[model samples]
Target: MRNWTISGTLTVEPAEQRTDLLAEPVAKALAALESPDAGVVEIDPELADTGAFCEAYSSPMSASANCVVVAGKRAGEVRYAAALVLATTRADVNGVIKRRLDVRKASFAPMDEAVELTGMAYGGITPVGLPADWPILIDKAVADSPELVIGSGIRGGKLLVTGELLASLPGAEVIEDLAKPVA
Candidate 1:
C-alpha cells in the first residue's frame, strides 16, 4: 500500500510542511491538531475540481472525498454544517442532514457565502478549517477509508489524510448513512 504518493506532477509532502499551499485557517487548524498522518500534494489550480483532480493525478475516485457546506434555518436562526462524503455519493441534504441540524429545511450554502465564510475557493471549501462551532458530519465510509484525498482549502493543492485523522478533527462526527450512493 502506498502510504506516501507521487503522482503525475504532484508531489506529496507531510501536511505540516506545505503551509505555503494551505489556506490560513487550514494551517491554523492543522497546527492545533498536529495530525501526523496528514499529507499534502500540490496540483495545478485549474484541476481542483474532483473529477479533474482525480483524472489528472491518477487518483481513484473511490479515494476522493468532497466537503459541502450546508445551511438550515430553525426559528429564524441559521445553522450550518460541513458534510464529508465520498465522491461516488451525495450528502443526504434534505433528509439526514436536515434532521441532524434540527431544521425544517436544509440546502447547500450559497456559493458566495461558502467562499466568503470558508475563505477558500468555491470548489475548495474543506472541512479542515470550518468555523469552530459548525459540526463536521463525515460519512462513515469516509471515516472508514484507510486513506482519503480531500480538498486542501485551496485550489492549488489537496490534503491526504487517514480516516482516523479526519475523524479526529475538532468537531468531526462520523455519521452512518450521512450520504446516499449516487443513483
Candidate 2:
C-alpha cells in the first residue's frame, strides 16, 4: 500500500515498514488501522517545520496539514484537544475550538506541556496518537483534500495520508470552518 500522491526529494515507503521514523504511539496507531494506506518518508529533522519542509522539497504548502495542540480550562479542569488545519490556514482556536472544548478560554498549548502529554516531539505532533479522550478537530478543507502531508510524530520524517484516513481516527470530528484562510 505504498501508493502516494505527494512528492519531493524524499522516498516514500509503507509506514508499517518504516516504523522507525514514527513515534511509538503514532506507529501503534497506524498499525491498528484496518486499512492503513499511509506512506512515510525520512527527512532532515531541521526541516520538519511545515514551511521549511515544503519549500525545501518543492511541495505545495496547500498539500500539507498542521496538527496543533490546544489547551483550555473550565471549572478548574484542563481540557486538551488537537486541531488539524491546512498549512495555508490557521485553526480557529478562540472560536470553534474553545466552544467545542466547552472552556472559557483556549490557547495553543505550551511546548513543554504538549510534548510531555503527547509523548511526541515538538513541531511533530500528529493527531493520530493523541490521548484517547482528546478530540481531534479536522477542518473540512483538510478532510476534503485528496491527500495530505502530515507530521509523523517525530521531526525526522513525515507521513502521507488521505483526508479520509485522518477523519477516521479514533476521536476525529470533521468540522466546517474550523479554520480561517490565512490572509
Candidate 3:
C-alpha cells in the first residue's frame, strides 16, 4: 500500500462520496472495492483527460492507467472489451486485441456508443463497471504497479487503487505485452 496521494491541490475523499456522477454499475463496483487503500480524489472536470490530469496534478504519466473501450465483430456478433494500459504505452488493439476478440478487426468504440453503453462520459470510462461479459485486458505492467490513478467513471474525479485490487476486479485479466511502448 504505497501512499496514494493526488498532488497537494486536489481533495481526496472516500470513493463512495463521489458516486453521484458515476454510472450505476460503476458506483456499485466501486462500492464493492471500498477499502482504506482505495479512494477517490476530486479535481477540476476540465482536467479529467489523462494528459491534463497528469500535468495538472503532477502525477507521473507512468502511474496513470487509461481504460479504453474497443469494439469488434466476431461470428456476426458485436463484441466489446476494455483495455487498460499505462499512459506511457498504447494498447495493442490491432495485434493482441484483435486476436483475443477473434475478430477480423478491432477499433476504439465510437465515443457516443462507448459513453452510452458504459454510462460514463467520454475520456472517463474506467474498467470497474464495464459490462460483466466484456473482457478487461490489463497490461502486465499496470497490474504490477503498486498504485495507479484511473478514472472514477466521471470527469470530475480520479480513483486511486492498488494494482492487486484492480487486477482482482471482475472480468480483469492481466496479460503480458497487452500494450506496446509508445515510441
Candidate 4:
C-alpha cells in the first residue's frame, strides 16, 4: 500500500490485512483493481461520519472525501450516480450533477434505496463498488489531492487511497466544479 500522509491514529494496513473490516463488494472491487495500492483502517462505526471520524481520529477534514448517492429520472427511467467531494465542500447535485446526468432534477437517493442498490451501509457508501452502470463524478479538487480518507463500504472502517486511483475507477469522471465550498 502507498504511504498515507493523511493517515490518522488508526493504523492503516493493506486492504487484505483486515478483510473483516471491508464490505463484500468493497473487498472484491479492490481485489479486481490492477494495483490495489490502497490501505484500510478499522474505526469506530459510530464515528463513521466524516466530521466525527476526522475529529476523533485527529485527521484533517480536508483530507477526507465524502461520497453521496444521487437519484434522478429521465423519460421514466431512474438514473443513479455518486458524487465524491472533499469534506470541505458539498456536491452540487442540483446544478453540476443534474446537468451531467441529463435529468430534470437530481436529489440524494433515499437511505434505504441507496443501501439496497449499492449493498453498502447507509453511512458507509464508498464509490468503489457501485453498480457498473452508475457514473461516479469526482470533484477536480479530490482528484488533485495526494491522498484522501474515504468510506470502506461499511461504517466500521475507512479506506486510504490516492486521488489518481479513484479517478481511474470504472465510470469515474473528474469534473472541474462538481462541488461547492461549504460555508
- Highest lDDT: give the candidate number: 2
Ranking by lDDT: 2, 4, 1, 3
Task: Give a tens-digit lDDT track for model 4, residues 1-183.
Answer: 577877778788998778888888988888899977799989999999999999999989999999999999999999999999999999999999999999999999999999999989989999998899999999999999888999999999899988998999999999999999988
Ten contiguous residues minimizing lDDT sum, candidate 2 = 1-10
Model 1, backbone clash pairs (residues 3+ apart or across chains), number: 0
List the lowest-lDDT window of 10 residues for candidate 3: 1-10
Instruction: For residues 48-156, write the lDDT of model 3, one tens digit per residue.
Output: 9889998888888888999999999988999999999998999999999999989999999999999998988887899888888999999999999887889878888
TM-score of 3: 0.93
Worst 10 residues of 4 by lDDT: 1-10
Clashes (backbone N, CA, C under 3 Å), per candidate, total 0, 0, 0, 0
Would you list the C-alpha lDDT of every candidate in the order shown? 0.88, 0.93, 0.85, 0.92
lDDT of model number 3: 0.85
lDDT of 2 at 141: 92
Q: Candidate 3: deviation at residue 166, Å?
A: 1.2
Cα RMSD of all models vs. native, in order, equals: 1.8, 0.8, 1.8, 0.8
Candidate 3 vs candidate 4, lDDT winner:
4
lDDT tens per residue, model 1, 1-183: 246542445677877887987888888898988546778888889999999998988888898999999999999999999999999999999999999999999999999999998988778789998999999999999999988889889999889887888899888999999999999
For residue 103, model 4's alpha carbon misses the true position, in angstroms, by 0.7
Candidate 1, which segments miss by more than 4 Å at Cα?
5-9
